[model samples]
Target: MSIFKPRRKMVVNREVQYDVLMYVGVFIVALFIVQVFTAYLFLDQVQRVVGTMSALEFIARYKISFLVYQIIPVSFSLIVGVYIFNRLTSRIAGPLFNMRRILQKARNGELETAEIKLRENDYFQEEINDINVILKRKSD
Candidate 1:
């Protein structure tokens, strides 16, 4: 059996934390985008009303265009952030959950319980291995 094992017990907690953080970050970014867009629209409307396409108007127009340019990147960031957070939490939580299930099975005198192998880069590899060691000892 490998030291790295998949986990499954902590699915709920990890997912909750990830969801909360992703929602909060997305909300803040969306709010900022709305505010900037609103300001640009307001200034553009004012300039239009005055019919003065002066330097200030030009600058506003350019900056508004720049903001538009940034929108795609910001949207990309939001999407990527949500995806990465979800993936990270799922990876971590999945292993714990699987390990928990194996432990429970072992407790019921399942000597041939499946081994809990963790990912090499997984954060909880050591813990899972230690637990496995303890189980092995108990089984013997």
Candidate 2:
């Protein structure tokens, strides 16, 4: 499908892309830490209530349930989150990259051809539209 067509370049703005990715990475790490801590606390409470099993023994016995209930969900969420963030940052960064190129062309007295036409899904459409109007008047 047209929507699935690959772009010529995935990382048009390296700085923005990497920065957003780093933030997402940090968020995922924080989430993982919280999940592990919460699971530990829950397991600790269960062991105390049972008064027979050690925490490690409980974990070892119910390892499959732990994996099914906690690890799997977190891993799946991380995958989905990364995919969504990548798409969102691309939409933002692609337009910014195009705007910079259009500005460079305008600086070189190429205003007539320096139209700011971004992808339909890209951010800054309204801003680019306003800029294109100004460029049109200047070229005229």
Candidate 3:
């Protein structure tokens, strides 16, 4: 048997995953706005010090450079952040989802053949194991 089993689904809970992603999305948007504003202020200061280029001229000349240097890196970081958060949230959500189902089965007295089986890397193993022991005894 393979020691590692990949998760078939990226999302275990839609509400939870979307909520997390939404918060992250909001934060990223705010961060990007602040960064762009700061960059613009710095560029304006530089133009004043140089006293050669008008604001419009400076922006027109360096817009491509700003996109290349700033937007691309921020976009890449946001992509990576979303991926990492999705995986991290899935690890927590997957175990909770399983636990809820298993506990519900126990409550309904349909746990005779049920066991709380979790992935190797999953959280809450100890808690689930304790519940399993109690359910096994009750069924016995």
Candidate 4:
């Protein structure tokens, strides 16, 4: 008979990760939208002051001008924002993924010592260390 019991399951800590990412994503999107809208409004006002009353008139009057002035920069900035948010979310999810994997091993009795290194100021460090101590004592 096998001495070490297998772990049944371990749930990843999704709530904190999802909530934080959602808030950050929303804030970034809101900021980007606000900036774009503000720029559009400012440009429209400036164009009106300069007698470029209509978008069609303006675009026709200036070849590649509209695209050069607005479309390219906004599109590029939005793409960069998306890439940043993706990386941010991945970073936030990484620790949770590691913790879940370790917990799974612990559950399976494969982890006789829970010696996962946590950050010195990490909020969950205490909990993890406590669990590690308990596991160590139990093993001894």
Candidate 5:
């Protein structure tokens, strides 16, 4: 089953993705802040272990390399997290946005709009099918 359908020309709301993006952005920022904090704390432990190594020496010799290694994983994970959830949330939100249009049309006595089904494998297909049944009853 497909996860995406071509959006209609009549966009009821262009900001359909805004909530997902905001949440994803917030999460990514929080994750990055935490990652940076932990990496520096780990650096402190490293410095303690080095005993005779001055902070300037440690930084000049190893700080950039260590932080790069730490940050690489965090960045990769953040990207993957945003990608996965954006796809997931979009699946739900797109249908909802389209369904709102259909339902609104039905409210104006255009029962034919209820016959429009979402794409295969799209989120909320079953619930929409039930809504179609209700629309059929209302039309009758």
Candidate 6:
């Protein structure tokens, strides 16, 4: 229902590649917000220098278009940010989610003997190996 839902499921120990991409995405969002603020400041200064009525006239003339330009990027950032974060989180969370469900089955003593598989794009190979090791030890 929300990003918060995925947040709860998101694996704490993610691969380095995922960490890098996630941080980079966050940095871009921050950079974009800063750019927007800087643009606002520049526009404000231009309006002040040009005098209020003239600035008001200019804004009135191009208000719709100007607003669209500003809104589009932020709206895109919001949409793309949610999408990227969702995907990024999913790549991490999905494996863990699968593992959790499998673990639940294992707890019920209904697990298959085959090693738990991860998606090609997913992480936690080390954890998977560890799980397999435990299973091997248990079987012996």
Backbone clashes under 3 angstroms, per model: 17, 0, 0, 1, 0, 0
Q: Counting only residues 3 or more apart in sequence or on different chains, how many pairs clash (N, Cα, C under 3 Å) in candidate 5? A: 0
Q: Output the lDDT of residue 91, model 5.
A: 77
Per-model TM-score, in order, reads 0.51, 0.57, 0.60, 0.50, 0.57, 0.64
Model 1, 7-115: lDDT tens digits are 7666544545666667678767875876677667656655654565777876666776556656765677678667866776676787888798898888787757456
lDDT of each: 0.70, 0.76, 0.74, 0.65, 0.74, 0.69
After TM-score superposition, what is the CA distance of residue 74 in candidate 1 from its true location, in Å?
1.9
Scanning candidate 1 in windows of ten residues, the lowest lDDT window is: 10-19
lDDT of 4 by residue, 1-140 (tens): 99999987753545545666686778678667856775686577556446635767665665455556567667676777678666666655555576778778878888777555655433345556776787677667
Q: RMSD of candidate 3 to the true fold?
A: 11.5
**97, model 1: CA deviation in Å?**
1.2
Q: Which should have the higher lDDT, number 3 or number 4?
A: 3
Model 1 quality (TM-score) = 0.51
Pairs in clash, predicted candidate 2:
none
Per-residue lDDT value at 77 in model 1: 62
**Whole-structure CA lDDT of model 4:** 0.65
lDDT for 39 in candidate 4 is 69
TM-score between model 3 and native: 0.60
- Return the candidate ranking by TM-score, descending: 6, 3, 5, 2, 1, 4
lDDT of 5 at 85: 83
lDDT of 2 by residue, 1-140 (tens): 57786757676557556867787887778678868775886577566545687778876877776666676667767787778788888888898898899889898986666788788787677778988888777777
Q: Write the per-residue lDDT of candidate 3 for residues 1-140, one digit (tens) a residue.
A: 99999868777547556766786887688668767775776577556545687779877877776666667666766787777677767777788898889889888987676687888876566777887788778778
Return the top candidate by lDDT.
Answer: 2
Error in Å for residue 10 of model 3:
30
